[model samples]
Each structure stands twice: as C-alpha cells, then as structure tokens.
Target: MELNNKKVKELLPQKEPFRFVDYVDDVDKNNKTIQCNYTFKSDNPIFLGHFPQEPIVPGVLLIEAMAQSAILLMLCIGNEISLDGEKYLLSKVEEVRFNKPLFPNQKANIISKIERSIPHFYFFSSKVYNGFEDKILEGKFIVFKK
Candidate 1:
C-alpha cells in the first residue's frame, strides 16, 4: 500500500528534523518490504554538532533512521502482532557499509526487506542511497520484540 510522508513520521520515534525519514513511499504487506526517504534539511540540529565548517549527517543517526524504517515495515506487515505487547526493536546490525557521505539538504532513500520472521525475531536488510540510487548505507539488521 502507499503510505504518505505524514504517516511515516508518526510511525517513527523521532521528532522533526531529528526524524530522519521523510516519507513511506510503499510497503508490501505480503512481501514484507518497504521503501522510505529522508531529506536532510539545513536546519537539522544534528548538523550544528556533527560538523562546523563542513557538515555531514552523522553515521550513527543514519543507522538509526535505517533501523526505524525496518521497524516501520514490520509493524505494517506483521499486522497480527501487537506492538505494545512487547516491543519492536532493532537488535542487530551486521556487514554495515557506508558508501557515500551525506551533507545537508540531501535526499536519502531507504529500501528495507524482511528476510526472516518468527514470533519474537524479525530480520531485515536496509540500504540507504542518494537520489541517484548510489548507496550511502547498507546493512543486515534484526529486531526482537521481547
């Protein structure tokens, strides 16, 4: 189904600007995959501290955004599961690769797909890329709702 920008922001935990994801482009409830995007604005608070003369999106926040995307998708597809019963969290990240640097006001695209799922564990991989589809971040991640 198609998800708008506003709905995506609400699904994520962070507030604006600090909320790295901008929109949920699509999610296949059956396939267990989702696509999202984030536009780095100049006014983002992280920019002020991440760099001074030249600003860059901190790698750690980038990972957080990616993880958020994965959780959002799981929530969408795993409709039978209740989020409040336990907690949907990103439990692991492996083989993470950052291919490019993200500066202010750049568009970051994220694509996440669920690789496996059990009653308690959700495994997924997400890739963050620039507008041109050049990879900025890629990793295999999982979350345990417990």
Candidate 2:
C-alpha cells in the first residue's frame, strides 16, 4: 500500500527532532524493499553542538534513518505479525561507510532492502543518497523485533 508522510508518521514510533523519515517514496513487498526521504532542517538543535560553523548530519543519525526505513518496510509487509506493543531494535550495524557528509537542509533518500531473515531478526542492506543521486552512505544492519 502507498503511504504518505502522515501515514508514515503514524506507523513510525520516532517523533520530531528524532524522526528522520519525512516521506515514503515506495514500498515493494515482493522485493522486500522500501524507499523513504528526509530533509535535515538547518534549525535542528543538534547543529549547535555537532559543529557551530559547519554543521553536518551525524553518521549515527543516518544509520537511525535507515533503521527507521527498515522498520517501515517490515510494518508494510508483515501483516500477519502484530507489532502493537513490541518495538524493533537495532541488533547490529555492519560494514557502514559514509561517502559524503549531509549538511543541513539537504534532502536524502533512504533505501533499504531485506537481505535475509531469521525468527525474530531481519538483516538489511541500506543506502542513503543525496539529491544529486550520489550515494552518501551505505551499510548492512540487523533489526530485532522484541
């Protein structure tokens, strides 16, 4: 099903300042993949401490964005499983590489695909691309539903 930003917000647990996903571009259940977008606001509080003169989106937040995207994908496809009270947690992050720094006001596309899955764990390969379509970050991560 196609989900708008409002619907995406409803599905996501993260709130303002922390929720990185701004919109859902696509969700392909057959391929187990999801595409989402987020724009780092220049007024974000983190900029003050991260760097005053040159603010950049932290790599950890980029990873968090990918994890959020992955969770959205799971919620979209796993209709049989009830995720009402349970939360999805990052179990592990592997081979993460930041190719470019994301500055405030820059919009990024986050894409995540399920690489594999076990009982309660889902492994994903994720990437974040800048507006010009240059890959800014790439990584593999595991999410555990608990």
Candidate 3:
C-alpha cells in the first residue's frame, strides 16, 4: 500500500529530534517487509550535548528506530496500529546487538520483518545499515496495542 511520509510522521508521537525514523519509503504486505531511510542532521538538539565535538546518533535511538519500524509495518498492514492518536509503545526488547556506530549525516537504512503479530502482541526482527552498506545494529522488538 502507498503511504505518505508526512502523514506517517503525524502517526508517530516521538516528534522532531527524538523521532529517528523519517519516512516509510516502501512496504510489502505479502512479504511482510519494509525499507526506510533516515539521516542524522546537524540541526538537531541531541547533537549539541551528545558529544559537542564528535556527535553521533545514540544507540538507544537506533533501537528505537527498529521499534518504530515495526510499528510502521503494523500500521501499513492494518492502518490502525496508532492507538488513540499514539503510534508506538515498546513492550519488550530482546537479542539486541550493536555491531557499529552511527555518525552525523549518515543515512540509516532500517529493514524490519514481522516475526509474528496477532492483536496487540507483535514481534519483529530488524537491522540497521549505514549509507555505505555496513551493518550498524540489529535487534528484536516487541510491542503491544494500548
């Protein structure tokens, strides 16, 4: 199904600097796969304090990105994953592995596939890749409907 990035942003509640996933570039319902890309811009608040000199996107945000990706996939399939105007609430996180670091201006390509989702209980496996095609992070995320 076709989705708008701007509308998707509205579905997400994280807002501005805190929300890392920028757009849902594409999605496949039959395959249960999604591809999205985001960039860490210099005009953000977190960078000012994250290092001031060697600024980079935090690892927590990377994991959050994976969770957000799973939420978006849910929305794409059902169009009602957002609860009472809220989009995501991470319930469980497992098998988290940080393979590399993410730096400013780098494009984060997040790909997620549903392990299972029925009702509010959802599980997904996700991976993050830099613009250069190197593996940056990977994890499994779980979310429940509120």
lDDT of 2 by residue, 1-146 (tens): 56788887788888876888988889889999999999989998999988899999999999999999998999888874235887999999999999999989889899999999999999999999989898999999999988
lDDT of 3 at 52: 93
Among the numbered candidates, top lDDT falls to 2
- Return the clash pairs for model 3, or none: none
Q: Which is better, 1 or 3, measured by lDDT?
A: 3
Clashing pairs in model 2?
none
TM-score of every candidate relative to the true structure: 0.87, 0.95, 0.87
Model 1 error, position 117 (Å): 1.9
Q: For model 3, what is the alpha-carbon lDDT of residue 34?
A: 86
Rank ordering of all candidates by lDDT, starting from the highest? 2, 3, 1
lDDT by residue (tens digit), candidate 1, 71-99: 77877776542355546667888889988
Clashing pairs in 1: none
